[model samples]
Target: MFVAAEIKKNTYYDSVYLMRITKEIEKTEGVIDVLVGMGTELNKELVSSLSMMTKEIESLGPNDFFVVAKIKREEIMGVVTKKIDSLMNEKKKNNVKEHSPATLDSALKYNPEINFALISLPGEYAIEEAKKALEKNLHVMLFSDNISVEKEIELKLFAKQKGLLMMGPDCGTAIINGIPLAFANEVSRGNIGIISASGTGAQEVSVLIDKLGSGISQLIGTGGRDLKDEIGGITMIQAIEALEKDENTKIIVLISKPPSENVAEKIFKMLNNSKKNYVVNFIGSESKNVSNSKTHFAYSLEETAKMAVELANKSTVRNKEVDAKCKKAIEELKAKEKEAIASAKNMVGNLSVQRKYMRGLFTGGTLALEAMNILRGRGMEVYSNLAGDERFILSNANDSYRNACVDLGDDVFTRGRPHPMIEPSIRNERLIKEIRDEDVLVILMDCVLGYGSHENPAGEIANTLNLAKKDMTNEENDSPIIVVSIIGTNKDPQNLKESIIDLENAGAIVVFSTAQATRIVAEITKSIGEC
Candidate 1:
């Protein structure tokens, strides 16, 4: 075997593009492994771990682009380098054909009517660009994460003063003016408007609403930090005010992780005064009744969508009638829960006692949190990399503990690399490792589809899942149950039906919602405990 390294000083490409190139290069004959990325510390470490790092790579700075590969022979090094060059040329040709602008000024000059800026950059460099966009009176959706809380507050306050919507520094999903942006789905247009701090949470609800024959008016995302006490839900408050005044939006749905008490109270007070009906899902928060007759508190994303759809369908109804609809929705959810538990029992046949733990490898952080919360609610002590409680935090984000749901999209896993959502293959290695663990009874995952997410995400992981199942069969070990929840719609670019067929064909038990998938895992765990 031989190692080949190439460093291009001052050359840079989008992380997602680099990841795609890496995937394509890896398919070349005689190529053992490859890492293609900017020379960030994390990427260097990753190359070292793969035993492909060299002194030249070590000397490259963050601004430099590098490719390190382990190959079968020296001759294959030429083949690999040519592949990388061809891919880079292909991107350049596409860029030329598209006539893409290189800067905000040029973009505005190209189209003066633009009112929205979707910024995705490294956090260190994102704030200035965001500030520039806000200064231009543009609505900004900042996709970059890792920005300081202080910087976030500064940007939000500026946008608020200007009466502009500042969606996120880390926001990933939104559907504005009937167009899907960033990581969002294509659902029908209707009377329900969603404001969420959780990206995947919003996607789950939006898709579910569509599945229930309802649709979305708008889906606004307030980057995850907007609801923190320090931020005081600035973007969320602005979103609510905008929705309240929107004639098209009659039912408002809010989704987020439980917020700080003061922030929650602020939100509650606003909801109390709203003339339109609302559904609130402070995911994993204790169930509590709101003082307002028009408000419904939901415990899950599914419930949030159901209640919103119910209210939208019965907009003319008042207090008692609305309450009755919500009650019926909750009852329907309970029935589904019971059915999930029954299905879980039948699926856990002849399982060995040693296979006792549930392991979740997720690309969506919010989805991971929801699963952890469900498992914890059911008396399981779930550990996670995204855990708010230190007691449940994983000591090493790379390794899973007794009952773990890991958000592989977390910064620890994504630094200097493309997000798992953009490159689903990032989770493949971890899934294989988990499948080999004898203690893992069940594996839970999510396949998020839409613009800006990987195309055919389910197909990317199917081979890994299939090989694992085959190996388990050959060894006569009960294969760990694999549960996948797809958060998408039929209208998405990635055909939803085909994605499900790929997973099902690979021996995965595929569900439509994250809540149901986690509940199924929780039920399977409960059965194991009883045994």
Candidate 2:
């Protein structure tokens, strides 16, 4: 065990390049972990968290990029450290067509035909860069969080005036022209387009659409704040108009947590006049029957994707195969629920009154909300940090409430590190401590797999869970039940077949959709809770 560090002064690299380098170094023999990124305060904190910090790193600046690794031996550190530059050089060699732009202005000058810009700089700096992109007639996707709502509104207004899409100041996922962007999945190009205010909501729905043999024409993200009262759905309104006129899109899907009352009313009005068919899944709102024939209101992502497919295939004619796929998956889950509950009751002997609550530790915000809604629908009390009701907000994010679900990917949990989707270290440690509490009856989870997520998320999840359960049973308590909704497709870099097998082998109950997983969770807790 030794640590190696390097500081490249005045160098800039895209996050994608750094992540790839990190993954490659992690695969090297004797390397325990790796971190490669600019020497920003957050990146410095990331290395310091692992005790890999040094005087070199302490002196580094924001514009500098670094590669930090912890290895088994000082000698082996040299072997593994060189892989970063080696692999990155290979990347540069393969890219014969890409011209290195010195700055954003130079980037646009290199190619004036560029239609979009993606800004992931610090939040305070994002608004100015976004304005510059809009001035150049380029759409902007702001991937950084922490931008003020006022700034978000101002930038979005400027974009709307220019008739360009400003995706996010914290937007996580989007797919444009058949290309997957940050935190997105790859799907075939087809007639359906997605406009979402929720990142993981769009991800789950896109994967579901891909699984159903339908495909996506485009996915436009309206940064989560767009629908709030202050911003008022500016980007979404523009997207609806753009997609309505897009000949390639025959059907559209809008997915998000419920918007402000006024914004919701405005959206409904826009949907009413939409010339093309569309489905709406406003999760927090009531399911209403919109009088417009072409507009369908969906209460869940599965329904939204399925309904959009049905409408695109020709409204009123259902795809029996797709319906059967949904039916079959749920039926399988129901059967497993019965078998697992009976087995749990038998193994644990009797239910401890203390072990009667559900703790949802989710990386996907949308999945957490979906599960919360399901439990609420079934008359169960569930608290979520993401919920509008301040009462449900946890006083300490590290602590749990009566019935709690926490989005591990929220800014609170991600201040000094990458998102849980990319780094499961924090969540893994938390889950271990959670399972030790006798009060935790179930741990509902989401293992999201795709590009820009943890390379092999299930590997860490399965291994950590198995180790934690060992300690639980040694104390003569039953292992807490883990129900998972894996958001992925077979086309992902991490093989879907093998990943599911790993989870199954680790004694997890995996479901195809978040909705089914939530149903199973409610049933499990109810069966044990009543006893």
Clashes of 2: 1
Q: What's the CA error at residue 54 for candidate 2, in Å?
A: 9.9
Highest-lDDT candidate: 1
Candidate 2 per-residue C-alpha lDDT over 194-298 given as tens digits, one digit per residue, 9 for 90 to 100:
999999999988888887667898999988888889999999999999998988899999988888888988888888877888889998698563678888888
Task: Give the C-alpha lDDT of model 2.
Answer: 0.82
Candidate 1 global CA lDDT score: 0.87
| Superposition TM-score, candidate 2 onto the true structure | 0.83
TM-score for each candidate, following the candidate numbering: 0.90, 0.83
Candidate 2 wrongly placed segments (more than 4 Å): 1-8, 13-61, 64-98, 287-289, 316-354, 469-477
Off by over 4 Å in 1: 1-3, 28-33, 39-63, 70-75, 287-289, 316-343, 473-477
Name the 10 consecutive residues with the lowest summed lDDT in model 2: 343-352
